[model samples]
Target: MRIFTGVILLTLSTTSAFADCGTLNAPTDQQLSSKAYQLQYRMEPDGLAVSQDFSVLFEVCKSDGTAVEGTPSVDAYMPMHGHGMNYRAQVEKLGDGKFRATGFMFHMPGKWQFKFDINEPQGSEQLTADHMVK
Candidate 1:
């Protein structure tokens, strides 16, 4: 009986933790998917502006809808210009597969690609999404 109760308590706690890190349902401007994960992100202050620094909040989940674990990183580049962002974005792990990235700036108005990299014990995958700045 005691063992059963303990198991129940542990299960509940684990479920609660995962629930807290539940999949992002909020509206986001950008989303990218790879074979292993799906990512959703939105820039702070709503829109992108040239030469303006902005932050992005993003969430990642596995194909099974479970939060992704391991190291996550973000970066951007302009394929046409063949240059990346002048400032490297700093990533903060918010737990449960959510991350906050700051120090992003789109120096020029053109087609830019946001790169999200997830490195896990199994392997690593990169997801890219395109954004245009006016």
Candidate 2:
């Protein structure tokens, strides 16, 4: 069973957007009926540096189940073991509640953490999700 640890943006219905990650625990049904987000990823070693490519798709409500519309500038940060992850996020919004963040490179890997920071006209929010990639 995959365990997901993060805030829920699933039940949101705003012109707002999201910067979330995916996992096995992600709802099999894309029809988000809650207040949460999910992501899927693939990590490859780029020479000596490891690059993390991922996408965070969130189903958020604007006001009481009114599907939100608007682009939420999304970004992902991969933190190193000793220091917080440096900002290497390459994020872009692809309309339709779909946003992508890539090129989150980590030169080394050991108990690393993942954080996504999303910016909207409303404001900005941060979420931290940790995982170890061997």
Clashing residue pairs in all predictions, respectively, total 0, 23
For candidate 2, the lDDT comes to: 0.42
Compose the digit string of candidate 1's lDDT tens values, residues 14-130. Answer: 555444544666464576766567788888877899988899898987765678877599999999999999999999999878899999999899999999989877788999988
RMSD of 1: 7.8
Q: In lDDT terms, which candidate is top?
A: 1
For model 1, the local distance difference test gives: 0.82
Residue-level lDDT of model 2, residues 1-134, one tens digit each, is: 12322223332322144323222234343323323332332332222234454444443333332323554443333444356445555655654444555555554565655554444465555445555555
For each candidate, what is the lDDT? 0.82, 0.42
TM-score of 2: 0.46
Model 1 scores worst on lDDT over the 10 consecutive residues at 14-23
